[model samples]
Target: MITVPQLDQYKDLIGEDQLSQIYDKVRALSGLHVMHFNTTERGGGVAEILQSLLPLLEDLGIKHTWKVVPLDDTSNHFTAHLVDMLQGNIPGQLEAEDQQAFLDTLAQTPILSRPQDSQADLYFVHDFQLAPLTTLFPWLRPAIWFCHIDTANPNQYAKEYILRFLNNYNVCAFNSQASVFKELPREHVQVITLGIDPFKNKNKYITREQGMQAIARCGVDPTRPLITQVSRFGRWKNPWQVVDIYRLVKQHIPNVQVALVGAMEAADDIEANDVLADLRKYAKGDPDIHLLHDPTMIRDQEVNAFQRYSSVILQRSSREGFGLTATEAMWKEQPVIGTSSTGLRSQIIHEQTGYIVDDTQTSADYTLKLLQDRDLWRKLGQQAHEHVRKNFLFPMIVLGYLDALTKAMAFAHAQPNLSGGQKR
Candidate 1:
């Protein structure tokens, strides 16, 4: 038989009072039919977050359904271009045809058809990819756009279209500061942090022998200082820059081995394979740099094992929604070095938990400093683990969503024509 854990089980970590507060609010969300729509079903931070979150919402007596708004190859090509637009790659204005294609693709997807078919109390759409779908399904109850990307900086045309699409939702959700998602001060934006489950399969405890075995399989040398960056092989993730930083670290600490572990998600990401292949060729001469994929590892749990075995983890995204990999690393008591902007700005507390580096030299300096002094990372690791436990766990994220849904409902109630969802 299948088993679901209790909400009160978190009391030991968060304390009785805190869990009680969560439970109180969670109970209020009972029978709430929540639908979370996103681009991919398996890859990236959004999918992984939903993997833990949707189930917990069900355990809390909320009817939660997670669906992927898939795109065809033709549509996905345009979608990838849209991702570029969000990353500020597209110059000048988006051609009117591309803008229409963006909306038209989402409109044609069958996954979104369920929103109009079923009676969901609230719609929680994730990322900019699915933001336009709300315009086609305003009757799907109160909608909240979960903008997981840095919307503040984008092509002017892309920003204009995104902000216009966002207006369809009653409110928008963000994890970073006001500058990341706020198009205007008047827009109703909910700042909710993304999270990771330390108790999940990847975050669960592993014996030394098992961890060593897993590391050995990844071709990571246990004696050498291991630096790992776990992210999709995307340009925005700055994977090439990460490899360059590792080379810089090698000059200072030659024994250091850098593991770039990534897996292609079933998203509309068209450039993943080309990027991964190019990076593989870029690191062909380096014996110390281990480039791995999910296919050879067999499962994502191995990536977790690599993180647990790592000396330090790197999530240095040039543009990040929120780097969940950094949180996963921190939870494992590993010192994480991430970039200083986007979601990484809020997660890594500079010298407190981990270092935030802007360039290769800065990253190398911090990596060398930590490697030279064992005591610093140990203390930082302890603090990093506590940071995730307190702020970025599954229970806390459930509460964040609850708070967003509450705001969405209130926003809906204020609308005389759009009044359909509950108020609690």
Candidate 2:
């Protein structure tokens, strides 16, 4: 394990008082080994959060090993199609071949289904896609699955499928309590809010001229009102719908610019490409609207600059796994307009920090409102920045996971019957 004086870097952002609290919390788990498993190391928010979190775990004296399950083209496609259904698309039932492919992926990925060799003290699995791994390696450790996807409105097929292995985990954690509480058993479910690193590349200090230069490099008109939605090209990101909302807003502000910015992340990641093609077809040759997939433009510094330069940030996800990008923009002092779906509803404080809008019409209205009233936008942006500083930084998320793990350890004692049980 690699250790560094990492906590001190965050003291400037979160303050020494809170940093000391986090150090104390982590110290409780000082010598424990932690293993984390997820579907991919990129493209998804779980991977992104873990990338930021693992080093901090090591710095805090936790022996941590992060693993990514290899999903071949077949199971990979199944994963993408499932997210489509979660985004409200129609999905065909999973065939026996699909199940076999999933099993093959788990069986083949040695690092993922580990201790078939050596076990860790705490096993952390992320989301439904990897839930089946627990059934394969049942005797791992005191396991808790961190669900980053929305469970409140899970796809019927996925909900039924995931329930098969829910018992395999000692405890389950969700992004928010409001939506997912009813979906899960009350005894074992935990609410650990997602957070971002304000000291990240995008969150670092930059000037207005630097931000404008970065936006202009992406072919955006810096003078025009710019509306940005920065996330994966996932269908749930509501990427195309954002274009529709942009066109509607354009009817009101003729010279306003719209930028749908994201990057393709997996070998079998075709959904982003499919959506981008549709967006290109819809945009056709309209110069005011930019459908960008340039790898150079998606870098953290570039994304940071775009958020800094945006007139308004759009987080119109239909079902969000907590709007980390929206929170990042809020940290950049940019006003966010998010939908009232799962995670986003909890992030935006509705006109205090930013606005909570439902449909594309409402999103457009708010975009126009921000474009029209500079003072309100500025005020909301300021409040949004402060809100993130108080609640959504890196240390807060690490502390949340540690707190939940401590509670999960207690829950296992109360429900000893469920620990590694094959049947719920």
Candidate 3:
């Protein structure tokens, strides 16, 4: 586990005083044993946070353990389809036979059915995958569902299918109120923003020469103004509009270049490939328009290097749970232009930290203006970095979780019947 002093590497990012506050709060939660359960161990934000957070929890003397249960191999395809359905790509009822088939597959795994059987004091269930545990393990102690997706206005068809599992959770942790709280029942809702590690693989420092080398490897010229967006190419990420905005910006500054770099999350390959095809059509053989499928895995330090060198970062997502890429770019001291939807609205402080746009034309205009004006760009980037350091760093998130856990403990005790079959 990383020590308190080692975490001091981010002192500039997370002030020393703030770290002390987090440390003090977490130390108070040392009595409870926490188990964090999620679907994927390596692909998305949930897993990434668990990877960094668990160690920090341990360091703070919190008896926390992180675990992941693999979806049944035979049902991987159905799980993929289910993911798409929940994301608003598909809408319909799961036929009686199909529903049984899914349950049967779920039954093959014992993780959900045995949370109560474990020794932990609290269970933190992440996302919809393990949501059924509340029914299967009625004895599980005071479980909380940490939802990462936007559920503010769920698709009626999708909501009907998922509500059975959602209502079983004791409480829901959403990235933002606008993305989740409005339509959800007020009885069980908690708004907790996501955070990033300022000193991680994504937001580390890189020299100008190193950044240029990474851009050259991608075959993109570093001399020109660069507008880059890094995401999973998921449907809601709006990659096509990113390309359109770049084209509009190009009309104004012909020397401008755009780099759309992202990797494929589990079962998202088909959609990513489709988005890639659309991006290529816009590229039209232009070398300046680059699409990287898995650039970082192939070239270590490539993304860190790219953000450090880029003139401006673009996160024009249509529905963002939270824009970590924008926060990461801002941490690298690059001006970001993001949409005013969901978590993007919370991350960008209008013109103070970065620009917030409603459409491609507005995004393009702001991108051009920020890129051309070096002074404004630097100031925005500096302020943006400070914003992330103060609000979205790992330490801050750990503090929020500790506060939630403390409150949850008290809430659990007050319920008197949360101990499964044995009323206090």
Each model's backbone clash number: 0, 0, 0
Model 1 lDDT-worst window of ten:
415-424
User: Is candidate 1 or 3 superior in TM-score?
Assistant: 1
Of the pair 1 and 2, which is ahead by TM-score? 1
Candidates in order, TM-scores: namely: 0.91, 0.91, 0.87
Extract clashing residue pairs from model 2: none
Per-residue lDDT of candidate 3, residues 1-424 (tens digit): 2247546666776567867777677666876798887777765678778888887777677888777767765455555555556555366655667666876766656755554556688878887666676666666557777767755555566566666665555566777777563444664567777788866766677789978887788778888888888877777788888888888988988888888877565442346777788778867898878887764442437777777788888887877778777878888887788887677888889998898887778888888888779999999999988888778877767766776687667657664222223321
Model 2 residue 195 lDDT? 84
Candidate 3 stretches with Cα past 4 Å from truth are: 1-3, 6-13, 72-99, 110-118, 182-188, 265-270, 295-300, 416-424
How should the candidates be ordered by lDDT, best one leading? 2, 1, 3
Give the better candidate number (2 or 3) by TM-score: 2
**CA lDDT of every candidate:** 0.76, 0.77, 0.72
lDDT of 2 by residue, 47-121 (tens): 789888888888778888887776777777887666655545355666778777777777767664445555787
Top candidate by TM-score? 1
Clashing pairs in 1: none
- Count residue pairs with overlapping backbones in model 3: 0
- Model 3 C-alpha lDDT versus the unseen true structure: 0.72
Arranged by TM-score, best first: 1, 2, 3
